[model samples]
Target: MNECERCVTLTTELQKDFIKKECYDKLFKQYTNLEKHFISLEVDNQLEQESFQRNNSFLQQSIPSFDQLFEINELKAQSQVKDTVIMKLKERIKSLSENLKEEKIKKELDEIETINIELDHRVTKLVTKNEHLKQIYKQLYDSIKSSCIRSKEQCDNLIKQVNIKSAKNSDLNASLQEKALVITALKDTLRKLKGKSEVDEAVTLHPIDPELLKIDVAPLAP
Candidate 1:
């Protein structure tokens, strides 16, 4: 081809390659963004799961204390009710007299006695319930404690696995360094061979001058 045709062909090829590169770059960017989006989604999901697990664990650990607090509050309310009853009884007894209407006082006393019996029943029921709760709490605590022990054991196992992986990584790094050295040696050998081949090509391409090829022979003397 002529010089002009060759130049045009080269320019056309360059434009074609440039267009291909632009398309490839845009496609690569889109692909990269998609991959990054997937990774981000996975990370978010993992974080949410971890957060939920933490909240669940914290609630489980605190359940017994909440139950105890409720029990204490109930006991306080019962004690307050008992104190009020006793104060009313004292007030009634002090106000009672032979002329101050005994029937009215007796009716009030009967009502108070009935209330006392109901209060006693309530106290007994509360005590029984408290005991039952204590037993249930103990059982739940034991189960949770054993589960924590298992989790600790699993964590220890994971640590051991991590240590083993670390050792393997060290071994792999050593092997990589040894292979790198071998590669460097091979590169040096390849460079020497290339130089030798280039010299051989140069010699083969350009023959020795006829004048330089002619040798002067010296006569052997006796």
Candidate 2:
């Protein structure tokens, strides 16, 4: 047997010897208590060992494999690359939008400049036409004035002749008065033509005045 059992057997034999009953009982109780304590310690140690083994097995199962770690790293790198590409694309789009806006503004400005130039050309053409009309009207007035003056001189000479021929002819005198009225009417017409020509020149020279394409002149009565 083991040491504890051998000690218990020796104590039992001593019980029949000269040992007192109280001492023997006390010694035997102590040995029994010690044995029980050792048994409890052994059981606790066995339980601790089992718990350690189970924890070790769980740790092994929870650890990641090498291939899994490599895959996770690759995914992180790809995500970073995609983010960089997206940033570049956004910058490019912003630049293109700005350029398009500038181009549109430039196109509009060019159109406005072209319209202004066309308007300038139209104004120049109108001024040129106005100048030509003024020259024609001036020449026409001079020609009419010359013709009327000549006719007046001829009528004055005719009046002198008629007055000398018909001193008491009331009908002849009335006819002469009518001829004088015609000469006065011709003078009025010449004055009006001169005034109208001046007005047309002023209108053409003014910056904001509209072009006058049509002009009305009174016809001379026969």
Candidate 3:
């Protein structure tokens, strides 16, 4: 009982700083224990009233001050309101942060899309140019190849003509050499006959027939 009444007494420090909710709750819990003990003590009082009646006055004294209880309730209300406000602020900040990140991502994506478009255009132009150059190169290569083949055929024809002309020239030279040898032999035989006739004066010469002396009587080599 004395302990319960001592808790109810206000300290000078509590008067200066004002009691917080935690202190009020602790005091209130102690008060409840004291009340339960008093109820039990009351039952004992009925059994022996004259013995505990003098101690029963401490129950009314042990009740916490009403002002302290009101302050505790006010403090708890203020703390709940502050916590709610802090939660709302945090949610708002998170929302703003998410929005900023999304915007950054969207801007980067736009840049990437633009780059892709430029790259696609460049690639298309390069491919078209490459194909055009390939066609021109093919045509040039074909023309060169055809020209080379034609030139080779012309050279072959010229070589064949030269060979034929060389063969004909060789045959003509051989025929001319045979004719020169026959003419030389005939001149030598005529000279020897002329010398013999001059030495043999006793033999009379016979007259030749006109047909035998004719220009076409004997044919020389053409």
lDDT of 1 at 190: 59
Clashing pairs in 3: none
Each candidate: what lDDT? Answer: 0.63, 0.61, 0.59
Q: Report backbone clashes per prediction.
A: 0, 0, 0
lDDT of 3 by residue, 1-222 (tens): 387655664364355335444554665565556555545544543444432333334434676467755654564555555455555655655565566567557756876897699789979999999999999999999999999999989888877777666666666666666666666566557658776555345335443343432222222221
For candidate 3, the lDDT comes to 0.59
Scanning candidate 2 in windows of ten residues, the lowest lDDT window is 206-215
Q: Runs in model 3 with CA error above 4 Å?
A: 1-81, 195-222
TM-score of 3: 0.51
Worst 10 residues of 3 by lDDT: 213-222
RMSD of each: 48.0, 45.9, 28.0
Q: What does candidate 2's lDDT look like per residue over 34-112, in tens digits?
A: 4555455455545554554564465478875676557545645554554555456555555655665675577568768
Q: Write model 1 residue lDDT over 73-141, tens digit each, in one string.
A: 564555455455545544543444232346446655876897699789979999999999999999999
The residue-level lDDT of candidate 3 at 28 comes to 58
